[model samples]
Target: MPQDDKISPRKPRRAWPVAMAVVAVVAVVAGAVTWRGQADDGAPSPDHPRNRGTELVIAVGDVAGGEFDPLKGWGSRPAQIRLIHSSLLTVDKNIDFVGDLASDYSVSDDALTWSFTLRDNARWSNGEPVTAQDVIFTYDTLKKDGTRFDLTFLDRMEARDDSRVDFHLKEPRSTFVSQLSDIPILPAKHYGTDYSANPIGSGPYVVADYQVGQQLILEANPHWYGQRPQFTKLTFLVLGEDAALAAARAGTVDIAYAPPAFAGQRIDGMTLQSFETVDSRALTLPTLPAGGKGKIRTNDVSVGNDVTADPAIRKALNIGLDRDQIAQIVLQGHGRPAYSLVDGLPWFNDQVVFEDGRTEDAKRVLADAGWSDSDGDGTVEKDGRKAEFTLLYPSDDQLRSDLALAVAEQARALGITITTKGSTWDGIYLDGKANAVTWGGGRHHPHQIYEMYSSKVIDSGYNNMPQYTNTTVDGYLDQALSATTQDKANEFWKQAQWDGQTGFAGENGDTPIIWLLRLDHLYFVRDGLNLGDQPIQGHGHEWALFNTLVQWHWTS
Candidate 1:
């Protein structure tokens, strides 16, 4: 679970918007015991690693870019969200959000007003009782003003009493309850205005100590009402890939987050667990920027003009990429090629497949659009101007840079000169004229489409980089959200997908962005690490590493 879709204000700038770019990262159902060759006699294998009593040390992929403010960077990044914090509702692997703090909850008849009953027995680490005021205060303090990394979902929240709370919505939102899973309930007494320095939480783990950019130390909360963690201390070491891998190989780190290049390698006395996700690597077309400091263009236009506003161009660009090749070759057959943003979900429509990357068809499509070669140069020209553009991506993400280079290579063949530029995550989307970048995440759900392409989200500085808008798509989205039956909602959702591809929701008629490949999200763990009875994490990280943490014991 990459935590790509959920937006939080206090999140690390590097991981925020970019975390969602990976394609094909999805939550997987737990494998059955029979499938793993468990003996019917109830005898365990002699060499099987099971329940080794020891401390668990994890090495995260990158350093924290911002403070450990759960309200800030920690809210958006799945790794941080799952380990360092726990929300009011905990979602299963199947993406069904179950109760965490609240013992039970029910929706109003109209689905407009929702009420929750807090667990009377729940208590914070500081021995303060968990009450309705904590929930209300958490929402008010973190969500009311909104943050750069936080998602904008709540309209207002009110506490009816110490044990009950009511959420009043502006309109009926089917996903409102599920969305509450994004906010981690904080103690009202601790986190008002002066809580940033001494943050307190009720999750299984609490922040023991934090170094600005080096590491965050989390100790298991002995007071947690749920099952106690086996490890006394969980250390999240933040470092670059090289340092992280080195630490993992040396056994200085227990869990490590690294790229595929690192996953392919083996370490002695450790284990590797390769898991798949529905996260797709993609390129976002930015709204063209007019002018800014140290930047000026001969023709000044709105940011949307940079790219994604043209249907034909976006379609041609999408059709040109050889997604299959990228999947099989570049990805080593880890993932499938994607046509739309919806990457991996059982409900995903299989009818759509665009594998023409680096093909003559894509070149022809662009050529027919009045872009052609001029002056005998390889690149295309339109109206005596070279069809040239620059794309910016994060240098830290190898897949993004590779995808950009691949697109640039194909663009050259099509007479469209696309230059590739790499920068830090913060700078990639800074001024918005960078053109495009690659992103990935878990499973393709309708919520992903709404979040990425919805016309209503542009102002939030999210995935609507192309500034695409369409009534037909919006209508489909509305029907999908309001429909009582999943079947009817799915029907409308499928129609929305079709309409989106037909230019109703995308950049004109063609997708403003070409979904290159559904990145087969992978993670490595030590040998004999069996996660028993895991949940299905549809499109988020709730199910992948965090949920299984409770059941995971050293089986060495």
Candidate 2:
């Protein structure tokens, strides 16, 4: 790492005090506004004109697992993990797979063998040369207890030499290329149980300092083989949305990740940077009926919803609610209507889109299915069962809470009572199987769609919560994974979503889940801080915002 011409790469003078345990935005803002003294090291504050393009400070959402372990789901998204680690492959700005550490890559004609030729110059920050042994060790270690990549397709992996590696699969899968980008190559010599705390990698940056729950400082890695980043020093602060916004206002942070709720606000020296994303929220209604067989997860936790089990009730909710209106009210026009989890992706079937916001259409569908307000109680019923169910959202997530509340309100017009409540993520996981839960997830690939709808992995680590079962859908999903080419696979993936006559879509279609909106990730960025041509974000994970950090530069 460079020692000269770089901002202080040691401690962050304005580091949020973990000992004080202060979380209030007003308190932090007050302190930032009141303390106008120069740093003890005499380094200009990040907001100073002299340091406009030399350094950067970013505020991000919570750190998963509070550690940077690649095996424990740290480098799963296009995030900071990319800064400290190298992979055989990586995604470009458009979320397209491209070679990273590997100088060249190719797949076998059988579509089961994948090969990568590593670049010779790649070296760890410690000056150790990266080797094929390290790549094999990464996969072997992940196979034991990995929480990020789905290794179902990977049968075996081997290294041909220091600059060569190959992966053999049990089956053909188009997502295998994307999965390669998720696993960060680990150093075999320094890897162990304690590697998470003290890490070394072959990426563009070195971890200079890290304060648990407070801040992280990174300096440019001098041994990096890739393009040099313009800025040499970077600091990341973990703060709640309120405190992050306050920091941006106080000129203590260069960029602050915010939700649409704060998109209307303005900062003194910052510009609102809104990037479109495939990240969306969907109300997953369990397809299984209560008191039925296979209702229990592997852990014995019961899962299923009686009301949502009725396809007609699910379809009614999907047709009645106006998604455009939800985007207007809940997201404040920062988002748009979404039909399926893979909307805007190549495999998405736009034919599933239908006319929404029609109360009469919803009522007619319900009535044809034998649900009506016979007693005039403003609630539809059929065979003594009322059309109502509880909806759950993460208590801390304001976007999801707003979405759930809006959906509940819209469903009222169709006499379908929806009870909305905010709960913890753990609570939602256990209880969500029996109730409709507003969940958020979207990536560039179709694996998530298969996992959520496939019956083969029901209740297997939150996959297929609906326990939806359709032989045709399952066959399509299976064929998607087995398709030899990406284009062929996309066709099958689309068929799984909607085959015209029967599928997972709403509007007389099997509606196991009702997707509402695709949101835009809004950020408060310092003026003249150009984020280059950033790719459209598919995952909601805040870390993905740093995907184009290498392309950032200053205009003035």
Candidate 3:
């Protein structure tokens, strides 16, 4: 939903390798390791020790291929890439961007040019000094080869000296620095077409051994400039959910990701850790017809249901639902009620709150818009057209299915008829055929709002799924991107939500999307393992659990 997992090349999402389908199910090993001195009731102990381990075993859903090519081998293997390579910038536990290979960076007055100075002592795993040339080579290679990331905004890249590199941009972009946090710098001299197989990097850890479809072993990098990892070895075992849970129960794995369904289940010596996420589940509303206003588009399409095209109908749907009940019943209390696309994030605007279950207000808005229950009929109708639309949800997602049913029931109480139906991702979202569908998304940066709601992204093939178009929304998003400082940019983002005239919550405006709740990520950790502070997660990947690997330790 963050556009990072979509397979389309034109879209902002990352493309997974075709081999992922073959490795979805892996065999579980027999005879898991058993440990003694288990905690009572498996609850975390208050007197647990710290920094007492030389090795750790973590169970993951999948294994990364031996390939370590930063340009070609990412998305599908984020954990491996992050451990083996170092980016110019990195985000801390607070989600704040900081330098990794770079010592400092500066932006020009017009925001069109940025310059970064490399840390003098930064060296690759092979003990070669990381220079500005490596940074330039990485950027130039990505631009020339057309990597998954969109770097078209860059005009040119130049290295002023061995320690400095400058980037000139075609347009001002406030989030450019944040985006650079994921692009790892590679050693240009050692890089080849097959470099992914034996990659060298400047990160704190290096790949020691790799066994395809089984496990990967990581060792501390002797030449790392930062604080060295305490653990001498880290082994990541490939396992499915059931297998991971089995391993955790038997004390074979030090850490494993757990879903909400495993909430009450307790292991003999493990602690369940829950962390907040920015990811949210919402419903998308169509604002325009499928076909162009006058001409035909690439593919033949039909105009969406006219009932949802009305702004009053969308507004009523937004304020008419009891989100708290949905969070309790649908999510089993694992999530919190969400009011906007970015409810828990720092940039989220608190002023645009929606009242719960305002059935009377919803009825008045629909009635004012020419809808009436004529002839004492329960359903509202105007000019022989009934207020009815079909709500679609993916057939396989239990959470979405439950939410759809709840929404339909609430809409019926307000004189609106909503028919719930099951649909596949391709059937409902590929061409935007369904009237309304449950949507998912969340991003670490506030630019996500511009990508999903701006009129400019309607034709971008990723977000703007409902074809929402507004000149005022586009202007505000542009201003947010061009702002000189982050504080000023945050104000512009808030304005895009509600500016008292033409925002998503303005008097005359109807929101194109309805938010429900933010899901929390759960994990099972062994009693002695101490994972450092973790930041709220975004939607794309699950590898963020090991972001603080350097700080992880075990107690006796």
Model 3 accuracy (lDDT, Cα): 0.71
State every prediction's TM-score relative to the real structure.
Answer: 0.81, 0.90, 0.78
Per-residue C-alpha lDDT of model 2 across residues 1-556, encoded as one tens digit per residue: 1233123333223444555547434444443332223223433233442247667878866653425676666765555478888888877876778889988999998899999999999998899999989998888887776345667668898888888989999989887766677678889998877665577889888888765555677789999998899989987766878788877776777888877788899777889988888888889998888865343334556667778998888888888889999999888988899888888689989888888888898899899999989999999999999999999998777788889889988899899999999998778877888889997778867788887888887756677877789989999999998888999999998888888787887466688889889898889988889988888876654676767778889886
The model with the greatest TM-score is: 2
lDDT of 1 by residue, 367-404 (tens): 78777675787876666656677778778666677778
lDDT of each: 0.58, 0.79, 0.71
TM-score of 2: 0.90
Q: Candidate 3 residues 1-556, lDDT tens each?
A: 1223222211122223436522322212223111222223432222321223687777755546435664654532233356778888877768778887889988898888889999999999989899999988888887776534557778998899999999999988877865577677878898887665576888888877654544566788999998777887887776656667766765556777776666678887778888777878888877874344311123344445577888878888777777888787676778888878787567777778756778898899999999999967688988798888888897755567888888888888888888888977657655354378888777677767876788765544345767787888788898988787788888888889888677865234557888887888778887877877777776633476766777877666
Worst 10 residues of 3 by lDDT: 26-35
RMSD of 3: 7.5
Better of 1 and 2 by lDDT: 2
Q: Which regions of candidate 1 fall more than 4 Å away from where they truly are?
A: 1-53, 63-70, 148-160, 287-302, 305-309, 344-351, 443-446, 478-489, 504-508, 531-544
Maximum-lDDT candidate: 2
